[model samples]
Target: MTSWILGLTGGIGSGKSAAAAHFSTLGVHTVDADHAARWVVEPGRPALAEIARHFGDEVLQADGQLDRAALRARIFQDPAQRHWLEGLLHPLINQELLANLAGAESPYAILVSPLLIESGQHTMTTRVLVIDAPETVQVQRALQRDQVSEAQIQAILQAQASRDERLRHADDVLTNDRDLNWLQTEVERLHRFYLSLRGGRP
Candidate 1:
């Protein structure tokens, strides 16, 4: 049977996780690309060994797991390195994402990825939902949530698709510059809308 997949994405710190979690509360199964990305590079994974071989053991923590922050800094500063890393890991992550999504039993499943549009993952979905917040808000939120420097956050923002570009491709947009109550209400409204698209499944 065909699954109705919703592609959910947004800029870093745009409340995508919170929105997805709320959707979970309503029984929507959500698969996260970030989680898949990490899964592909777990300590025992071939991808992790390849990364260490290419970038040296510096990219690995003493415990043998990927040093995500070190690797993030390395790639963000070099476009060629970033491309190489993406080339290596994107396919693996995609495979895992597809498997998890295919197993979803919900009437409609959500694939949450910060790079959903950029990585072409949206092609797998029936609809694209963008959780949007202003750039300033994004920066502030990221600053509060991560231990990274402002410069590092700026680099990440630069690497991602521009805000307008995401909106241009979005089938639905959830503006997240507001409070949690507003977000929950919007999620419920969209949840109903998505169910209706599936003939209003209970």
Candidate 2:
């Protein structure tokens, strides 16, 4: 039987990781799309070889691993390149994501992706949980956490769906502007709520 899936998403620095981590501690299996994305492009993977073929060897590091930052910069600068890369990678990433989610032992699993809605992965989920914060908060946290330049962060923000769009599609919203304790409380509350939605199935 398919495990119920909760699609978790948020813009950059919106605390999706922290929320998913808390869910993990509660024995919920979680599959992260970003992790799947990386796995598909690992050294020796067919996707990496294709990437090298398309973008040249410079996109690979001395160790033959993908130079992610270089690829990120290039895709962000060129819409055509970004679309081409996504077309190449998204199917592979989705396949891995579904395989992992299908193998989950928990009653429900969380599929966390920054682009859950935009990428149409939400269709696989039984519920959509959106983590949210003000854009200012998101920018400041991203700057401190990732150390990327503001312009790059702004470009990423522009590339993602707007906050309003995410909210419009959300089945649940967790505002993460406060401390971790508050976040934990909300996660716990939502955990119970999700479990209850299963009608007491163990």
Candidate 3:
């Protein structure tokens, strides 16, 4: 709770998870907004109830679990639906993120969120670190990593904060457009930088 907070963000497929993994290896107290978002809407949760009420039972699977893919498709296609879903979830997710941050046990903690900029999660941190990559790279990475097509990926890109906007808000940027080794080196360099900022040696 007394540690510095680092808000780490990037657009979808910008290697946010990979960056988070590197930070984890360095013992950074890390909390993922995506994980928190999913956590807040688990099957028996009140957020799930609200989601079901707004999107209907078809949004749930036969096992009575929220069908994430179906909901993603719906929200991307309907701006109003997406807005409603965000309005219902962001507050709950924030609460979970704050709780996690408060429980962090490190010189600093990293809040990894894809929507850190778009959703104003950066306000909760002392600095913002963005993982940067080209737009085409992002689309290709998403196509390979996720079960979605180009169109769906494009829809997500359209809905997220742009590369420029994200960079504009970044206090630091970790470029992930090259090989994994390069990314790791960059991350380690930043990790040390963060430690130095905290008046410690990594």
Candidate 4:
């Protein structure tokens, strides 16, 4: 089957996860990049070995698992380190993502990646969907959701592509400023549209 893989992404705290969940409820299987990324670096995985080799033993926790908190602090504090880490992980993540896609049994799949655009993974997707909300809402949601300070949230946002950049690459834009009912309605519409695109009934 010609899988209608859609790249689903948004700025931090833009409700992309909520939007992706709604779409999944409508029969679209969602393959989360973050989850796949984590799987690649699991204990004893080849990716984990490579990571340890490159970044040293400090990136691991006392139990020998990936120290995500320590790694995040390191990356956020240094641009070169962040890029180096992405270079190490992105390819492995994409490989596992493609393997997952190959085994998918759904009408379509939603590839939810926070860095879909910046990481250049959108090129593998049939279309791009962006969840959008005002920056104020993003900041508020980030602070509440991640329990981080405004300064830290701003730094994270600064490292990512701007709202305009996301919109510019979007084939579909789901606004998340409203209630779940509105989001469900949009998902229903998209479900039918996606089926129609593949010559199937809703």
The parts of candidate 4 lying over 4 Å away from their true place are: 199-202
Candidate 1 positional error at 109, Å? 0.2
lDDT of 2 by residue, 69-182 (tens): 999989999999999998999899999999999898887899999999888899888889999999999999999999889998999999998999999989899999999989
For lDDT, candidate 1 versus 3, the one ahead is 1
Per-prediction tally of clashes: 0, 0, 0, 0
Model 3 regions lying over 4 Å from their true place: 199-202
- Residue pairs with colliding backbones in model 4 are none
lDDT of 1 by residue, 62-121 (tens): 999888889988998899999999999999999999999888898889999999988889
State residue 197's C-alpha deviation in candidate 1, in Å: 0.5
Identify the runs in model 1 with alpha carbons over 4 angstroms from their true place.
199-202
lDDT-better candidate, 2 vs 3: 2
Candidate 2 versus the native: TM-score?
0.96
- 68 Cα displacement, candidate 1 (Å): 0.9
Worst lDDT window (10 residues) for model 2? 193-202
**Candidate 3 lDDT over residue span 138-182, tens digit each:** 999999998778998888889999889999998888888998888
Would you list the C-alpha lDDT of every candidate in the order shown? 0.91, 0.92, 0.89, 0.86
Compute the lDDT for candidate 3: 0.89
- Model 1: what TM-score? 0.95
- Candidate 3, residue 191: the lDDT equals 86
